[model samples]
Target: MLSLYRAGYSPWHRLAAGPKALLLIVIVLGVSLLPVSWPGPAVAAAIAVGCYAVPGIGLRELRRQLVAVRWAIGVTAAGQLVFLGPGPAAANTTRVGAALVISALLALTTPVGALLDALERGLKPLDHLGVDRQRVALLLIVTITMLPVLARLAHDVREAQRARGAPPGLRHFAMPFLVVALKHADALGDALTARGVR
Candidate 1:
């Protein structure tokens, strides 16, 4: 479920992990910091969608990223719509979409080992402060991989509800999701501890 790397012969796949990760952060931040107007964020998102045309990435990867983040996009849009009005919601929604696409693009192009190595190298400055760079890097990578799993869990829970003829609402959804999420957290914690992480 956490496999994000696709073997490819493209330049993106060949690029060193440090630069690739940095570019991912820069592009996402640049999109987010754009003026809180429709065209800015929307256009950024459109360009992000267009990134699928790059040599290694394809329509299939794009759709997977969309599927993985669909519920999140929906919830973010709805929350903003109810609280902040359509303008902000529209901007934030597109921004979120663009960011996810870009992040997923990194995962699709770069291998997990490459990313973890890059993260450890980048965090070396903190080693002098008693930071365990390997553990920290692994933690960061796990977080990146976990996002899609969480989204998938939400989708499965929703589908299960529909299959069982349960009502479609958060009230009915929250408890089950919470329980499963907690169990997930507990398992992750146990795994980390077993690996000698404090």
Candidate 2:
């Protein structure tokens, strides 16, 4: 789903991924530091929405992505409203929500491979410091790819366990998940080695 979203032919899709990721970080930090004002968050949300207006980007698909993160937005909003007082506290919550939505839009429109390449290029200077830039880049790529895969695997495992009458508990889930994850990691490592990535 994520890859599909990133595969569009929008202008944002044409932009280099590395710069887009940096822009995302900057936007988040800038919005967070700005005083709790309605305009800033509103503008951020508008920009995120406008990004969807770029040609070849389906609004429905963007809506789906927003829906997927609805729970997170709800949690943040609820926590802020419950823990903090009202007024500016609630505004902060909205600001965070806007930032998350904007970030998602950026990711949705940017290709992962391009982004990874950009990251690798940006971190090139670290190689002089003996940081093993390629290894770090590979690790980052693996980590990013594994996140969604792991989520799907966990969901499937939970459903399968429930079907087999196993109790839904961490004790029953953790070991199997870890074992499966390790197997995947080993397989990925083998593939990487075969491709002379290390």
Candidate 3:
């Protein structure tokens, strides 16, 4: 799930990050502002499919994204079912599913450095307000990069606990995971200090 980028000579891959980001924002807003009706969701789903048809988005990548969101899709459907009945529930679920796909598509197609560069460029206007665009871009990059690392660390900690015959609950793994995470933070802090980064 973390290594979502796929190298290819597709049009999407060649597109500038600024334009891509703008298009992504437009698509997301269009989908979100749609009326919560059958046709709206259906159209949204079709748009998502069209996005898949764009170059670089292959069946394998699509399938991986779908599989990754299966749980969220199921839970969303179930919740909407209870509150909105079948028709609206389907519409809402489809909208959410399309959004997830679109997000994954963007992440898979764009390089992190490109995204950061784009963000810095886009946010440059805010510099007058004392907003540091470069700093903001760096923070965003660190956040995206850290999420998968933390997830992997948690998975590894859980596996290690299981191997040691520990119980299945999070309680058994929490302390060790916290300790390791703190050690990771310390090392990162030390590195930053040595590099004269505030």
Best by TM-score: 1
Per-residue CA lDDT of model 2 for 93-146, tens digit only, reads: 667766666666655675666666877898899988989777787677666555
lDDT of 1 at 45: 74
Each prediction's TM-score versus the true structure: 0.78, 0.68, 0.73
| Clashes per model (N, Cα, C within 3 A) | 0, 0, 0
Name the candidate, 2 or 3, with the larger TM-score value: 3
TM-score order, best first, reads: 1, 3, 2
Displacement of residue 54 (Cα, Å) in model 2 is 1.8
In order, the Cα lDDT scores of the candidates are 0.83, 0.69, 0.76
TM-score of candidate 2 relative to the true fold:
0.68
Q: Which candidate is the best by lDDT?
A: 1
Clashes of 2: 0
Please give, for residues 1-198, the per-residue lDDT of candidate 1 as tens digits.
Answer: 255688997777888999988887888888878777757987777778777767777767788788888878999999999999999888988888888888787777888888889999999999899999999999898888888767767777889999999999999999998887788788878877997888
Q: What is the alpha-carbon lDDT of model 3 when measured against the actual structure?
A: 0.76
Tens-digit per-residue lDDT, 44-155, candidate 3: 9888888888666766666666666776799999999999899999888888888877766656778877887998998899999998788787677666556444555676
Which consecutive 10 residues in model 1 have the weakest lDDT in total?
1-10
